[model samples]
Target: MKRTDIRKSVHDFVSLRLDDHQAFADDQSLQALGFDTQDIEDLMFRLEDEFDLTAFTEEEDRLLKEAVTVNDLSRFLQKIARH
Candidate 1:
């Protein structure tokens, strides 16, 4: 999938999960948008389902621990899709 499409999917999922339709920047922090641990996990599961990923690798899990922004997740998804 294209990077922009992945990014849009991320944004759409986040907005839908949060029940917020407001536009947010790629650099915007998920925490700042009220994403708790559970919310992040839920998003991950949703993304995995949407992208047909079996599961995240250990290295990817490590990176996910450091992810803070929408762009971070988008980048991660892009990398996963390429593999």
Candidate 2:
């Protein structure tokens, strides 16, 4: 829920390699950050591991494109953890 916690969690998922956190301030588009397609998979896996959530299916992965910020991704993961 807190933006700072969400940002921290996402940065940890990326292994802190997202070179442009400032530009991503309000955007969660992985392509905009130049993250390779598989990098997104890796991040999803990291989130799974971090929060002990089930893996997202291929369809769910595609849905992540709509998530546009660390906060968005965090909320997504929170939804995941809840169910």
Candidate 3:
């Protein structure tokens, strides 16, 4: 999928889960928006379904721990989508 599409999917999922329709700017921090472990798990499943791929591999899981913002995840997803 295209990067923009991936970003949109990510934004849509996050917004839907949070019940916020506002567009998520690239700089926004999901953590600041109240994301927690459960939310991450939920998002992982949703993205896996959306993109037909796995997320949060053991390596990626470690990387996820440092991802504090939307852009961080967007880039991570882009990388996965490319491979």
Highest lDDT against the true fold, candidate: 1
Cα RMSDs of all predictions?
1.6, 3.3, 1.9
- Best of the two (2, 3) by TM-score: 3
Q: How would you encode candidate 3's per-residue C-alpha lDDT over 26-45 as one tens digit per residue? A: 78887778888667766766
Alpha carbon lDDT at 9, candidate 2? 82
20-80: candidate 2 lDDT, tens digit per residue: 5344553566676777657766776777677677845864576456555556566667667
**lDDT per model vs. reference:** 0.80, 0.63, 0.75
Better of 1 and 3 by TM-score: 1
Task: Assess every candidate by TM-score.
Answer: 0.86, 0.64, 0.80
In Å, residue 37's CA in model 1 sits off its true spot by: 1.8
Across 1-83, the per-residue lDDT of candidate 1 in tens digits comes to 88877888899899996765778899999999888767777787798789886555784576458779988888877777776
Pitting candidate 2 against candidate 3, the one with the higher lDDT is 3
- Return the TM-score for candidate 2, rounded to 2 decimals: 0.64
